[model samples]
Target: MTLDLPLIWAGLIAFAVLAYVVLDGFDLGVGILFPLVQGEANKDEMMNSVAPVWDGNETWLVLGGGGLFAVFPLAYSIIMPALYAPIIIMLLALVFRGVAFEFRWKTRRGQFLWDWAFAFGSTVAAFAQGVALGALVQGIKVEGRAYAGGWWDWLTTFSLFTGAALVVGYALLGATWLILKTEDHVQRRAYTIAFWAAPLTLAMIGVVSLWTPFLHPLYVARWFGWPNILLAIPVPLLVLAAAYILLKGLTERRETSPFLAALSLFVLSFIGIGISFYPNIVPHSVTIWDAAAPDNSLSFLLVGAVVLVPLILGYTGYSYWVFRGKVKAVGGYH
Candidate 1:
């Protein structure tokens, strides 16, 4: 079978985004959950749970951005300008997080300051991305190739809802990750959190699913229409089932099952969104084909992916393998 290079690139970009969501999602969830940690010891255990794999989890984000720049320059140009403020804030938050991660360990004094910074940064970054997702879904105010909306235009009720939903979603991911990576008290707390967070996330998904159609009539038609409806419904139903299993696993003291089930729900929900917005990179503003780069640029990127993607996969696998097992309260960073 011959390849459709544009679709192939689109798939690669989508895969990169999904990988980031799963990998970085847990760590960001950890960050969001930081403030709720009861004591220094618990916080240390929480941080350690993600320390080994957190850095590598960001690799998929780089791939997502780079892939877009290489294969969909038009979308990049449009999105970046429209999201300039949020993007700037996100970058700054990430920088703050990186610094806090290193410095939080180095100093005995000002430890609380660093902890707050880390948590704040994580919340900011997560919310900013959520707002961007909401704006994209709600459709950006575009005229020709430029963004014509006010700065506050991005901060709508829908965006705020998305922001809160993402925080809940990330918290759920973090809870399940902790369930998998920690033991004893930490694990118990995580399981409790998961039991609560999972249902909240499910409720958020339901709200977003219902709201999206009313927010965008086109999306409403797309979802309610004949053939597409058949494909779209199953993904959400599967996600709901996964969430149910996650809750059941937590209650049964099946530690590993919650993480797997949580991951499955995330993947299914992501796939549902992808299906809902097939061929549209920036919702109504830009179709994938219109936003995609020339075939020559795609071919060049494809050649690089041939080497880079496999190397990334190998490294990610190796890191996880090396760090596999429950987190222990080692005295210091190793």
Candidate 2:
């Protein structure tokens, strides 16, 4: 089966973005979960669990952003202006989180300050990312490759709602990750958090799913029409099943199942959105075909991409493999 260049590029960038979200999400979740942890020792262990690979996990975000810019310049042009505010905030927050991760263990007297910085920065960064997602799904203002809206146009109620949902979702990922990466009191605490967080995540999913159809006729029709309904049923069904497994794993103290289940839930959410927004690279605006660069440009880019992307993936997998183990709470690697 042959494929259109634009379709191939769109799918590639979409997969890259999904990889970034799932990969970076749990570490950020761990950061956000820090304050909720009762003791300094537990928090240190939680931080240590992510310390080895946090920077590597973030590489996918850069790849995703660069791929979008190269493959779909038109969509990139429109999205940046619409989301510049939140994007800037998100970047700044990430910087804070990254810096805090390094500095928190470096200082003898300033650990308190750095710890707060890490937690706050992670929370804010995650929230801003959700805001950006919300703005995308809630519809951005675009006209002829430009954002045709004011600076505050992205600050819609629906966007805020999405942002809140993402916080809970990331917390769920973080807790599940802890279940896989720690033991004893820390593990139990993470398990308890996962159990509660999953239900909250589900409630948000339910609300977002029900509310989203009303936002656009394309999705409304696609989701409710007969064949689409039958075909689309699997996405939600899988999501629910994953949610059940996640909670059950936490309850039963199954170490890896919670993390794996959370990953499945995230994948299903992305799939649902992908299906609902088919043909649209940016919903209600640019399409894959319309936003794609010239065929020759894409072909040339694909040659380099074919080589570079796999190397990045191999390193990512290897880093995870090398770091695979329960974290020790020796006050983190300073």
Candidate 3:
């Protein structure tokens, strides 16, 4: 079968972003849950739970960005300039969090300081990405392939809502991860957080669903349209079912059910977004075909990705296999 370069690139972009969400999602969730952890021993256990896999998780972000730059240059050109401030803030937050993750355990005097920095950085990075996502969904002020909006244009009530929603969502992901990786006190605390966080996340999704249609008439029309509406309905229903199952599993203290349910929720939520924003990379601004790279470039990258992506998958699998068990409080960074 012949390949459609645009579809291939789109799939690659989607895979990269989803990988980032699931992989980095756990570490960020750990960060969001940082402040709630009590005692040095607990903190050490939390850190160990993620330390083996956290750095590797960021590979997806790099691939996602690279795919955007190589395959959808137009989207990158428009979005990078429009979100310059938030992008910078997000990068800085990642850097600080990475440093704190390592340095906090190497020293004795300023551990609290690093702990706060790690948590703050994680929250900042997660929220900023949400804001950027909201602004993209809302449509940037584009003029002749460049953004014409002011610095404050990105900061709106909608964006702020998106920011908070992402925090809750990531926290939920973190809680599920804890359920899988920790034991006793930490796992119990995670269950409690998941119980509350899931409902709040659902509320945020409802608000966003209602608000999007009003903010952009096309989205409203898309949902109201016959066949599309039928397809869309199942996504949300699946998510709700997954959320319910997650709560039930947490309540029953089922070992693996909570994480499976949470993972299903993430997958369903991603499908909902993908359905809403199909064909459009920058929402109302540009369609995927309009922003696609030259066919030759896409073909070359496809060749490279076939090799690189599998390697990433293999290494990620190996790391998880190597570290598969409840984390212990070893009291120091390796």
TM-score of each: 0.95, 0.96, 0.96
Candidate 2 lDDT for residue 293: 95
Per-residue lDDT of candidate 2, residues 287-323 (tens digit)? 8899999999999999998998899999989988887
lDDT of 1 by residue, 1-334 (tens): 7667888988988999999888888888888888887888888888888888888988998999988888988888877777777778877987887788889888878888888888888888888888878877888777786666777777789988988888788888899999888887888888888888988888998898888888777787678888888877788778778987888998898978888888897798788778767778877777888888888888888999989999999999998988888887674333
Q: Give the Å shift of residue 87 in candidate 2.
A: 0.7
Better of 2 and 3 by lDDT: 2
Model 3 scores what on Cα lDDT? 0.85
Q: What are the per-residue Cα lDDT tens digits for candidate 3 across 255-299?
A: 688877877877776776787788788777788988898899989
lDDT, residue 52, model 2: 89
User: Candidate 2 — which pairs collide?
Assistant: none
The true-versus-predicted C-alpha distance at residue 265 of model 1, in Å, is 1.9
- The alpha-carbon deviation from the true structure for residue 237 of candidate 1, after best TM-score superposition, in angstroms, is 1.6
| Predicted model with the maximum TM-score | 2
Q: Give the TM-score (vs. native) of candidate 2.
A: 0.96
